[model samples]
Target: MLVALREWSYSRILLVAAFLSIAGCAAQLAPPYDKTVADGLNSANTEAMTLMAATSQGTDKNSFSAREDTYNALIGTLDALALSAGARPMPKNRFTDAINKVLEKRGGKPIDDDDSTPPSAHSIKKIAETLTKMRDTDKKQGVTAIEAQAFKGQLVIYFDQAITYENFLQR
Candidate 1:
């Protein structure tokens, strides 16, 4: 009876120690985001926007080659952001969702035979307007603070250029 009790107490101690060890490991694996992650995300967002602008320009010029290059650049930037965030073990889904929302607001639709050409100049203006509205909404909701700020600036630039291009298209 005495031997059994001693063995049982030792087993409980071992189990508790093992549980504590596992918890400590989990805590170490998911540290909070530091300045490095924030800076990397900012850089990635800038690069993505640059690529998106290039893609829009290529589409305007009807240059198929430029389109692919721009698209590839955009994807590469996005991938880098994802990897960096993952290394920090930060939640990437929110960031990705923010990006998808922006794209969706910008006339994102599935490509089909009926939609072979890019949107018309009028349509592009409408898309830009819609994007601005979405940015405003995001700002109101208090989600994606950094993205909202950056997007507001980008949208202004895009809207002005879009208007100019549309005017040229009309001539």
Candidate 2:
């Protein structure tokens, strides 16, 4: 009976140790959650939706010139968000470090600074690029309703990804 108790205690110790290790590792994977980041993401999504709806049809659809400032401003907001995300510390994975070295030896520009960029930043950057493309399209033949909706869909996906990631970090 004493031997069984000893074995049970050992097992309990191991289980607790494993749980502690995992709990500690979770914090290392990403930065702590920031309320401001969450707020910013929600605000950006709201503004983007409003803008896209306004320009999806009618006179506003082709009014790229008039809305140029709005487009530029949105792009700037995304860029700033990306910068904010990138500024946070994220531990580098060893596998990516090795891959980056190999890419550098091959004289290829290592993608995304050796994967140092946080996922949220990457998503935000993509959002900015998509918006820029939308702006250019508007400047040209002007975005059709179909095109506008398509762009809006893409933007929604990107925004959701970033927002989801930010929320996940809170956990």
Best by lDDT: 2
Q: What lDDT tens digits, residue by residue, belong to model 2 across residues 1-171? A: 999999999999999999897664532545778778778888888989988889766334445678889889989988888899888877666545666588787986645453566788888899999999988878877887888888989999999999999998887
Per-prediction CA RMSD (Å): 17.9, 6.5
| TM-score of each model, in listed order | 0.29, 0.70
User: CA shift at 101, candidate 2, in angstroms?
Assistant: 17
> What shift in Å separates residue 49 of candidate 2 from its native position after superposition?
0.3
TM-score of 1: 0.29
Worst 10 residues of 1 by lDDT: 113-122
Runs in model 2 lying further than 4 Å from the true structure: 1-27, 58-62, 93-113
* lDDT of every model, 2 decimals: 0.44, 0.81
Tens digit of lDDT per residue, candidate 1, span 54-121? 43322232334434454454445444443443343323344445664676678768323322222222
